[model samples]
Target: MARGPVGQITRGTTGTNRLRRVDRWIARHPALRRAADPLVVDLGYGASGVTALELHARLARARPDVEVLGLEIDPERVSRARAQLELVRAGGASFAPDARVSFARGGFEVPVPGGRRPAVIRAFNVLRQYDEAEVPDAWSTMAARLSPDGLLVEGTCDEIGRIATWVAVGTDAAPRTLTVSLRLAGLQHPSIAAERLPKALIHHNVPGERVHAFLGALDSEWERAASVSPFGPVHRWRTALSALVDAGWPVRERSRWRLGEVTVPWEAVAPG
Candidate 1:
């Protein structure tokens, strides 16, 4: 008589290290670092649970007590992940045997046992398949399950994980920041991030939209900063991003430029 998971099944396309860009970002977030519970959820983790294991391994470097729970709506996926975990526990896998991780069957409702609310919920490429009109409700349903100071990181990335974009949503379901991370080596242009933008702003990347203008500026700066390419992509990125700061882009986190990352207030690209 119980109800079913609140979301739909996804294509389950996954690859090793495909989420490294995002995982590094989450490890530094306060929701995972300073949480009283330090419970992180990998919601809709596709057909494999390796991403969840990878997340735990990376985060544990910062929060040794961090716990990662991989949730999937399909019971079969849950079984498969548990089987993978068993190998890990038996020293047959690469991850630490005592890694604090688990697998569960759930969805956007984010069902967790022990009355524990997750400090961070990461749903990547889960909502991109849904219609744009349904994004808000999906975000609200997931964000509502977070702790008071928790964060909901939702985003999309390329198949190989070179380009990525995500939104940091608060417990109120209001988006706080938009981040674009790319592999600077042999990069074409920063505007390439537009193709991987999260669902909320993907369709709004047309002319007259704020996101479009932002990407335009990003590409323009990248092109203008080509003079520094001989030095290195990091130098090129810093030079380009510095120009944006001077041009009044309201870019945040100057230190992250070395990583080819740019974080801006959500309002910067919110749909007009």
Candidate 2:
């Protein structure tokens, strides 16, 4: 193995607010809210440092002491983000002047000072370029750098923030839940999230597969819930989620349904 970062460099596509959905989910996660060390890692945070800044702003609302460390394997990208961080520190950016954010060159090995472990690691869109067979090892490598009660969030989303899906992995390196979040208004169907499924489950979205079955069920319930559309997309979304629960799907986090998001136990949609 090479003596450096454990992963390959990928497309640096990034935009403002592109990760709001996942950031919202992480902000509310117990892993950050209750951790002894409220340190968060924004691994592979693309071309700009804005996502890391946004993550800290969002997480700080819940855990005032939350610190975000943005990691990238590419040295130039790291330098560029550090420049952005300086602007923020100088109060030239929209974020807080002293936002607890930093940039470093690292990958799945998740290097930090003095063997410190992170409370949550958000590795969004970083694994899309890797072979599906490589996901477990990648996840295990990152998860090993987490605190005992920490979480590793891995997922993908569209260019805009509308549709997103992520898996919450525990320090044990086992995926616990899969969450699908979308912009309900004007959405044709809930299953559009299939296009953005995380690398771990994207290819498994096929006929006779667990994910295929789950999205199929979601689309069906979405169509069936159309009668309540007049009440607005949020209500319609809540209806579909309620029906999914009724239909025996192990859906969780009912409070988030109104936001056009639903989470299910990983086993419910893991490839079979």
What is the C-alpha local distance difference test score of each model? 0.95, 0.94
Each candidate structure's TM-score, on Cα atoms with residue i matched to residue i, is: 0.99, 0.98
- Badly placed stretches (over 4 Å) of model 1 are none
Q: After superposition, how far is residue 260 of candidate 2 from its true place, in Å?
A: 0.7
TM-score of 2: 0.98
Report the lDDT tens digits of candidate 1 across residue range 167-203.
Answer: 9999999999999999999998998998899999999
RMSD of 2: 1.0
lDDT of 2 by residue, 1-55 (tens): 6689999999989989999999989999899989999999999999988899999
Worst 10 residues of 1 by lDDT: 25-34
Backbone N/Cα/C clashes per model:
0, 0
